[model samples]
Target: MRVSAKSDYALRALIEMTNRTAERAVSAEELGRAQEVPSGFLQAILADLRRAGIVRSQRGQSGGWRLATEPTAVSVADVIRAVDGPLVSVYDMRPESVRYQASAEVLQHVWIAARVALREVFEEVTLAQLASGDLPDAVTARTAHEDAWQSH
Candidate 1:
């Protein structure tokens, strides 16, 4: 599954916020500058995140955006989904929505397995872990594999 730039920027913004004073709200412009995201695009992303209940916005001199929940409670998948929808899809539809003929029946299981594996990683990883640069043992092990870094 490929994450969109919007999702990536949203995640980066969240990570930046994690490193700041949680009690203080951060303006989109400030976040964009710190994260290197375009200010205009970051505003839209912040709105989407607000709509998803992942963030809360204030509207005055001291107004800005802040996480609605603790960083540890927000998964990477949550941020990605808020901005980009599902974690995995085939032809823009979920794996469960896709049907396969007898000749391709086994392929469905493969797709499902792939989706499950991805969820196993994304679902278990929270923004706190990422912002802290402390990954889980399973995630570290998977990335440590020689094949994990291969171009193809």
Candidate 2:
């Protein structure tokens, strides 16, 4: 499953917010700059995040955005789902929801397995773990694989 730019940027922005010690609201501009994401695109992603209840926005001079939930409670899967919908889809349909012909009967299982594999990583990680740079052993072990850093 390919990770979308939206998910990457959303996670970056969330991590930045979590890293900041200030209680002040974080402007879209600040977040965009912090992650080096285009301000316009970042704003749209932030809107998705807000709508998902992952973030809260404030108004006025002191108003901006902040996490609606604790960092530790917000998983990477949550951010990805909030920004990009399903983790894995076959022909735009969910893996389990897709029906296959006899020849491709096994394809659905492959896609569903892909979804489960992605969840094993994303569902296991939280914004706090990412921001702290103290990833769990399971996450680190995945990194230990020599092929993990190789381009597909």
Candidate 3:
């Protein structure tokens, strides 16, 4: 359930790109500066996104970076997976692939359920909604709960 720094930075950079009106490519440096992420780390993230088909890179004077698809087609889950692998992993393995002893046999179900819970939100939100600041009703409803903001 922990969100990695790479995922956060990637989402921030993508959101910045989604908000921009310019048709020009966005340099890694510009994305890093705009999102307040480290330049080198951001470069690696951009590369990952490109390989994941979440983004496309251009070379030469007018070359930089851009989303490979429309913002609405790129969900938060997509960005997270693009930069950080699976949304949830049990010991770096898929939840269903993990085995547990009799005492903890039900733990696998918990992990699978957690993955589903994450998908319920992350997969439901897109870069367009995030960049436009017009979140889906389901997301807004979750945020409206006072308990959602308080740290346990």
Pairwise lDDT winner, candidates 1 and 2: 2
Q: Candidate 1: global Cα-lDDT?
A: 0.89
Comparison by TM-score, 2 against 3, better one: 3
RMSD of each: 1.3, 1.0, 0.9
Q: Output the worst ten-in-a-row residue range by lDDT, candidate 1.
A: 15-24
Instruction: Note the clash tally of each candidate.
Output: 0, 0, 0
Runs off by more than 4 Å, candidate 1: none
Candidate 3 clashing pairs, residues 3+ apart or interchain = none
lDDT of each: 0.89, 0.92, 0.91
lDDT of 2 by residue, 81-108 (tens): 9999999987888989998799998998
When 1 and 3 are scored with lDDT, the better candidate is 3
> How many backbone overlaps does candidate 3 show?
0
lDDT of 1 by residue, 8-119 (tens): 9999999998888476899999999998899999999999999999999988999999989888999988998899888888888888889888899887788899988988
The residue-level lDDT of candidate 1 at 149 comes to 92
Question: How high a TM-score does candidate 1 get?
Answer: 0.94
TM-score of each: 0.94, 0.96, 0.97
